[model samples]
Target: MQFTKLGAFISLFSLISASALTFTLGAQEKSCFYIFTEKPRTSVNFYFAVQSGGSFDVDYAIKNPKGVIIHSDEKQRQGDFMINADEVGEYEFCFANGMSTFAEKVVDFEIKFQDENDIYKAKMPVQPNSQPNTHVEGMQTTIDNIDSQLDNLLKALQYYKTRNNRNQATVRSTESRIYYFSIFEVLLMVGMAFLQITIVQIFFKGSRKQLV
Candidate 1:
């Protein structure tokens, strides 16, 4: 019973350890976050999306503890990456909004760290000695399956959220462009009307002067 309880606790802790953050980046600015690992061979999962921005894109980079660039991209709107930490220390993730001059960018990101030892322990074989051991093994398997499904669902939701944000930004930009175009069209029509009236009045005055 104690072993079962301990397994449950570890699973819960692993899931809860995932870190998520949402931040705004000013024009031509950069932001970075760090994650520390105590031991080598840890697995890291990273995900990021630009919720709203000028072009729905930004620059990003991930560096290892030794300052070696493990991953980098330019003009990316969203991404998902998994990497292994061979050296134990701090890893840096950075985002840059240098392409935008006046627009601020809103970004959402998630980071997950998994210890190899815990993973191996969770997958260890069950001895064929007692019924209780078999039951605990089955329960752990069920929990792992549930955790995987939950992760997939979360990723799907994030994808949809990114799509929604992009559509909204598109709608707003189109609306503003249409508004400006309408104002310009109205001003041009008004100027033409004024010019036409002035020309007609000049012709009548010339005719009157000729008769005088």
Candidate 2:
């Protein structure tokens, strides 16, 4: 019965948590996402990482409901930010790759919103309890602990995924560089050999003419 309740709580937490998303930005392109806050003083958490592409960096901007830029950065590889939503409207988050002329970028990000009222309401009540009530309270505490652990696990998984993607990209870029360098080396050697042969032939021809 305890395990069943814990599973249900975990499911609920999953539904409430923000989902991670992947965004591909073409060269000189900008992408934006909108988040709405119904009440003032809501907490918004923004997390992002550049998983691949040139230099693994991008420009990011956060705008409030009034279309004013509140937070902005340039050539950032990753960021985690918390914003206080003071206005009750749609806020905008944007990512731009204007610095890159031909290299596209792959970015992973997530946004989570926590309302003060919701947090307050979610708190379990503690009061003078009989035997049955005490038992129920203890079970609720265990469920809460499990939920917190699961959330941490989810975050760890996301971090690993980002690292893996970046490593793979690095490997591919290195291989491409090596491949092109090898081709260039071969071409240079062939050109040098041809030049030497031509020089030797010209020398022999001039000598023969002189002898004649």
Candidate 3:
């Protein structure tokens, strides 16, 4: 019973350590965050999206413990990456907003770490003995199923979030263009009206002078 409780506690702790964050980057500025790993060959999942800003894109890079660039890109609106930590140390993830001089970028990102040993332990078979063993096996199976479902749900939510962000950016861009076009059209109409009035006045004056 104590062992089962301890396993449950560890699972909960792992889930809680997975993190999501949102941040704003000013034009021509860059931001970075770090995660520490205690062992080599741990699986890391990284995800990022530009929630709002000009062009809906930003530059990003992932660096290993030794400052070696593992993955990088420019003008990317969103990305999902899975990497294995080859060394035990700090890993850096950075985002750059150098593409726009005045537009700020809103970015959302998540990082999750999976320890291979924990996974192996979770999959290990249990020795069959009494009712307690059977009960524990059933509980573990249920927990695994729940964890799988949660993972799928998280993916679905992320997809919807990206779609929503893109739609919002489109709407904002269209609205801004429409506003500028309307102002230009109004100014052009006013200018044409003034020109026509000036032409009519000149014609009438010339006719009077000719009569004189």
Candidate 4:
């Protein structure tokens, strides 16, 4: 089958940094996915990568429940693809070296989800009780959620959107610190001025009294 190649467009890149890839709990809106396209046709190519030192083999179909096999790369050309997701839902893509290898092989993939859309394919097969792949999918979900959070944070910083009153809170905190520090500085200067005046008066008073 002909997998959709990222249409006539600019080359895109999405890096799932170590921190961006791991978040076992908390928010579910953001997630990150690593995808490798042997013949990438769409910017939305979806796949998953391994964690830490363990390298993984590649598959050309959906390896997880929540994901979909949107396309498959048969040409067997592998490269990095960055995904920027705007919606949350099932996404599908795959990695395959069957055209070449069958042993303990290692491949890296990056999938970008714009909004809360978090779905990923697992390199290994599913388990009976615990899903080895679910964890990777979950990590991708967290990363996707982070994208949204990061966007909101950036907007707040840029004054685009005043979300969660974050901008106001930051301004208030900064103002409070500056105000207190300024008051303390002024008070210190005033005390020094008073001390100088008192010393001058004491010295002059002694001279005047002796003259009188």
The digit string of per-residue lDDT tens for model 4 on 1-212 reads 12222232222334332111211111111122333332223245333342211122233444222454434444332333444332343343433444333233333333443222223422333457984576778876786688669856843443322222334545666899999999999999999999999999999999999999
Model 2 scores a C-alpha lDDT of 0.79
Report the lDDT tens digits of candidate 1 across residue range 1-212.
00011112221123244777777888998877777677788888889999998998999998897899999999999999888888888787888999999999999988877655554333545577745666777788897898789889999999999999989999999999999999999999999999999999999999999999
lDDT of 2 by residue, 1-212 (tens): 00011112221123343546786888998887766676788888788999999999999998898999999999999888788888888787789999999999999888777654555233466567535576777877887788679868977887898789989999999999999999999999999999999999999999999999
Clashing pairs in 1: none
- For each candidate in the order shown, give its overall lDDT on alpha carbons: 0.80, 0.79, 0.79, 0.41
Over 4 Å off, model 1: 1-16, 118-135, 210-212
The number of the candidate with the highest lDDT is 1
After superposition on all CA atoms, what RMSD does each candidate show versus the true structure? 7.9, 8.2, 7.7, 19.9
Misplaced by over 4 Å in model 2 are 1-17, 116-132
Residue-level lDDT of model 3, residues 1-212, one tens digit each, is 00011112221123234678777888998877777777788888888989899888999888898999999999998988799888888787888998899999889888887665564334535566734566677888887888789888998898898889889888989999999999999999999999999999999999999999
Work out the TM-score per prediction. 0.81, 0.82, 0.82, 0.27
Give residue 101's lDDT in candidate 3 (0 to 100).
96
Give lDDT: candidate 4, residue 79: 33
